[model samples]
Target: MKNYKISAIATTKIPPERIFAVLDDFGSWPTWMPSFERVKVDLPTNPVPHLNYQFRLRGSVVYADMQVIEYTALSRATSFRINVPPLTGVNRCSIRPLSQGRYRIDRIDTIDLPKVVVGVLDATQRARFSRLAQEFLTALLRTAEMRG
Candidate 1:
């Protein structure tokens, strides 16, 4: 198996608190995120906090089920893979307070896949992942800015 780690950072003109608020609310993802077509937990009301959910990719229709492993208010959030064959990865989002009403948003994704498929997948999937990550962060930043 081969490990793939993708890390990205973005500077936003929004406060850390606002950014963290948006990041913590997983239910609101589909509202602002263009890449996620649907997001639903197992419950209707108040759902089971920290539960897992299956997400459908907007274009590719790829589905990935992820479980909420760690969620710290206004600081850090982490999730673990629960689906997607032969791939187990942890997704983490963090926010740091920066100078002058600015904040640093960081996403760290660690994926483990088979070595044989790496070359084939890398050429096609890497760009898609990168673009998705960038778009997700950018959307979050835009939402936070609008809320301010």
Candidate 2:
């Protein structure tokens, strides 16, 4: 497996609680996340460790399962992919509180893809993926900052 990892960190004006609210709701991700089609959680309860979800991403035909491995309110969360061959992923997000209702958000996405598939992705695709990540982050920030 060829591993591809992307990490992003940004300081946002939104508070940690607001950002965590958006992160905890799996189904809401499609509204803000780039290329994210749908997500179905096994449990309706929010952000519990060991919670599992099925998700479709980037218009892919296959659905991936993810189980929450660790969760802490307004702080950190981590999840691992399940039952997906040649494309396992371990994704994590952490938020740190800053002064004046600001926060720092950090996200790490580690994907294990087949070597052939990675090889097929040209420079343009790589750049596009990077842009997608940035766009997703921007959307998350916007969602968290919006007034109720």
Candidate 3:
């Protein structure tokens, strides 16, 4: 299988804690993130600390379920993975405080798939996903700014 990685970084005026909190709240994703049509927790009534969530992507009718495997509240780092058919990727989101009132948001996604499919995706589909990531980060920063 071939591996695909896409990364993006953006600076925001918001603090790491606020950014991390917003990101950790999976249910609120659709509200702030325009790319998702819906995000629902299929588990128990109470919140699951390291839970898995199922989300339906907007525009396209694709559905993916990802597990929140890593979370570090102090460092403001969280990661999720989708290990199912059609999509197999890991997404890591982090925030680091910079000098002054600025903070940096970094996102990295690595996907694994067949080599032939990866080559095709690299030529055509990967760019779209990259753009989506950029837009998502931009919207996230804007949302955070507007809330303050």
TM-score of each: 0.74, 0.73, 0.77
Candidate 1: Cα lDDT at 100: 85
Candidate number with the higher lDDT (2 or 3): 2
Score each candidate by Cα lDDT. 0.67, 0.67, 0.66
Q: Residues 98-148, candidate 2: write the lDDT tens digits.
A: 988777887777888888888998889888766766676788888877732
Which candidate should be chosen as best, given TM-score against the real structure? 3
RMSD from true fold, candidate 1: 3.7
Q: How much does candidate 3 score in TM-score?
A: 0.77
Residue lDDT tens for model 1, 1-148: 8888777789877777777677656667668976455654332365334434333222233345556666665445454454445367778777777888777788878888778877777656787888778888888889887877
- Candidate 1 lDDT (Cα, 0 to 1): 0.67
Give, for candidate 2, the lowest lDDT window spanning 10 residues: 50-59
